[model samples]
Target: MGQLLDGKLVAASLKEETLQQANELREKGIVPKLTIVRVGAQPSDLAYERGALKRMAACNIDVEVKELDAEITQEDFVKELKAVNEDPATHGILIFRPLPKQLDENAIQYVIAPEKDVDCFSPINVAKMNVGDKTGLTPCTPTAVMEILRHYEINPTGKDCVVIGASNVVGRPVFELLLNEMATVTICHIETKDSSKWARQAEILVVGVGVPRLVKENWVSEGTIVVDVGINVDKEGKMCGDVDFDNIVDKASMITPVPGGVGSVTTSVLAKHVVKACKQQNGL
Candidate 1:
């Protein structure tokens, strides 16, 4: 049987280090502030925001929520976005995505200053990330995945890594991060027929698809390091990961739990990004 990867413990450690640095900055009179630009009142978005608020408060980071009505005009929305971007006191900007169809999502993302884009939503940061530049902030979820590996001292070098899902937010960024670490990467998505065939090849497998328990026991190789990034409520309303924990746990070398895993680490990574942004903007 594989050992459990305790993401809650790992997240606590990461947040502790970040909190120490944040306190030091506070002593120097620099407050690390993150402004969340939320457009609609999405239940899922609200839940995420609540969790983020709790985490940021615990870390002593200031959070400003810029809530706009869903029906607001695109021009006014962009104007509101610029207000936060131009604010010197605001170190990081995390925008809730899937804007009203009237607004061009890509255009709004470009409007955010790259330095203030903590989520790495700006094209400038994306370009820097693609070319393997580590200066810009990485997408928090992917960074959390890397943090998990680092905390566990799991080296990806010379390993065959298979990444399931290919979205801009998690999968693609993770694939790039793994490649940068010298792992041979294969990215599979919804379009990929028989994804299990690819997954069985990985020494390290990272899955981000939202479907609950999509990976069966036969899908994984023995001793493979499984990082389950999915946060889904199963049909029975129990929180679960992409991989079937009970079954696959015995087959894999290590696995991360759903509620206590990547989600917690992601919030900690966001806090870290805010501090980094504060330092950069303060010219420190």
Candidate 2:
């Protein structure tokens, strides 16, 4: 049986570190703040928002929610983003993603200030991340994955790392991080041929495709370190990860379970990023 990569434990440690930093900032009369700009009433986003609120409260970080109507126009959405962009009180801004269909998110991405955009939504931050620059905040989910690997003492150097998702939020950024760590990295996507062959080649496998249990037993290779970044609802309404936990557990060296895995550490990373942004802004 494989060991579970306990995200709950990692998140707790991070919260402790963040809490200390927040307290230090408080003593200096600076309160770190995170502003969540939620445009629509997405049930998923609301659930995540509640989680983030609880997480931030634990670290003593203040959260301001900008809840907008779902029927808001694209121009209005842009205005909303700009409002937060100009708010000097907000140290970090997190916009709920996949904004209403009418809104051009790519265009809005450039509107948020890189320093205040803890979610790394701004083009500048994304560019910085792409070139391996550490000057700006990285996307939260990818950072969570890196934290898990570090906590578990999994060294990526000289290892073959296979990333199974290509979205900017998780897969591509993770591949870049692994590459920087000197890992030979390969990224698989929907169009990739015989994707399982590539997965089987990984000493470290990271999956973030939204399809539940997309990776099965056959995709597993002995001693593979599996990090399932996907959170999906199965036909039975049960939450699961990209890699099938039961079938692949015995075949792997370690794995992150759904609900308690990659998902757990994400909000913690958000708080960490907020603190980072606050310090950078205050010249601390």
- Please report how far candidate 2 places residue 21 from its true position, in Å: 0.9
Best by lDDT: 2
Show where candidate 1 strays beyond 4 Å. none
- TM-score versus the correct structure, for each prediction: 0.96, 0.96
What is the C-alpha lDDT profile of model 2 across 112-185, one tens digit per residue? 88999897888888788778788789888998998899889998999999999899888998988888678899
Identify the runs in model 2 with alpha carbons over 4 angstroms from their true place: none
Superposed on all Cα atoms, the candidates' RMSDs to the truth, in angstroms, are 1.3, 1.3
Clashing residue pairs, backbone N/CA/C < 3 A, model 2:
none
- Tell me the whole-model lDDT of each prediction, alpha carbons only: 0.90, 0.92
Q: Write the per-residue lDDT of candidate 1 for residues 159-185, one digit (tens) a residue.
A: 899999998888999998998888899
Instruction: Score candidate 2 by TM-score against the native.
Output: 0.96
Ten contiguous residues with the weakest lDDT in model 2: 126-135
Error of 1 at 106 (Å): 1.4
